[model samples]
Target: MAGGRKPCRAVTARLRRSVNRRPGTASPCPWPCTFYSVVAGHLDGGEEVKAAAIRDAREGAGITIAPENMRVVGVMHRRAGDERIDFFLVAERWTGGIVNAEPHKCDDLSWFDLDRLPENVIPYVRRAIESFHRGVWFDSFGWEE
Candidate 1:
């Protein structure tokens, strides 16, 4: 953790391609190549994991996900120069149309097949999606022995 702060707790909201209006939808984050990523961010202080997922979906993608609509898919303990505990949640159903809620943060929003994700996806995110499909509930990334 940075500055002696506790390990960060984050949430990732995975919107499946089937649930999205179009497949292969991607939101490029000003990277060299267009990449796919889930709606993810740090949990607010005193916020529950599921609540964070719901908030991120609305704030990042303009989708309103009910608590029942969100499913806990995976939990990842990751180290990328710092420690972060990630809660991966899948939104099976939601209301309202999807839009790029944070245009300043992302270019556009799109969906891609989880099974055949593009190579540009952040590696750790891709791993979490694959694990979710495989029925794995726990995963870790960027850790060293």
Candidate 2:
């Protein structure tokens, strides 16, 4: 939503990995974590947005999700001396399993509760999750205005 600049389109997935608890505890714990990533050059020229989401989810997290199973959860206008638009999607159902497709690029891919996310998560990604829970459809970050 900046001036006349066309925002770059990107997609991220909020795939809930699993549930966990302390070593001997028997109580249900919060959702372990949601998946996320900046689509890795998979968005071909004018490719369908949902298609890109599916591809990203597969390549980044090793999950195969259909377009119909995905939902746009939030959009983030992110700036870190540069600006871009990110589309966040949530997929509770998918075929196949989760794996680190790009192990070289990711050091750790573990489940984390939203209330206790890792300190190293991308700032915009975290904000997008917060916005999703708040039912905020749109948000801007790293801008003074």
Candidate 3:
């Protein structure tokens, strides 16, 4: 949470597998940064958390994830020029092929092994993935002590 009364809320969809046997995660390119980042977007007015994750997955990744197959892995209160709460949810299953639903916004969409993620993932995204693997639930980023 931020200093404001209502901080913006966002959702990041982390896929456990994208129609592959290997355990992996997929994301879009973080434009201008050359780093990979998961499917994420701001929540709509009065949208539920998991519902937003499902919606973002479809809108950003061209996949449909059932609410029952998605689970909250982590939550981050981040401050990067703005304060926002990010929900990181992992989906064990999804239907349809994975594609870059927003080519204009993303250069490419690809999957990486969970144990061998690329070195150039977005900082907080990488942190969230690591935290998910480590079973940590809550984190704060971009805020100085």
lDDT of 3 by residue, 76-126 (tens): 988876677888888888899888776666666777787788777777877
**Model 1: per-residue Cα lDDT over 1-145, one tens digit each:** 4677776546555546522221132433333435557777777789888888788888877888899878887888888766788888878888988897877666657777776766777777778878887899999988867
Q: Write the per-residue lDDT of candidate 2 for residues 20-45, one digit (tens) a residue.
A: 11111231212222333233323555
C-alpha lDDT (0 to 100) for residue 128 of candidate 3: 83
Show model 3 residue runs off by greater than 4 Å. 1-5, 15-31
Report the alpha-carbon TM-score of model 1 versus the true structure: 0.82
The RMSD (Cα, Å) of candidate 2 is 9.1
Between 1 and 3, whose lDDT is larger? 3
Off by over 4 Å in 1: 1-4, 18-33
Highest-lDDT candidate:
3
The 10-residue segment of model 2 with minimum total lDDT is: 18-27
Clashing pairs in 2: 32-112
**Candidate 2's error at 9, in angstroms?**
4.7
lDDT of each: 0.71, 0.59, 0.72
TM-score of 3: 0.81
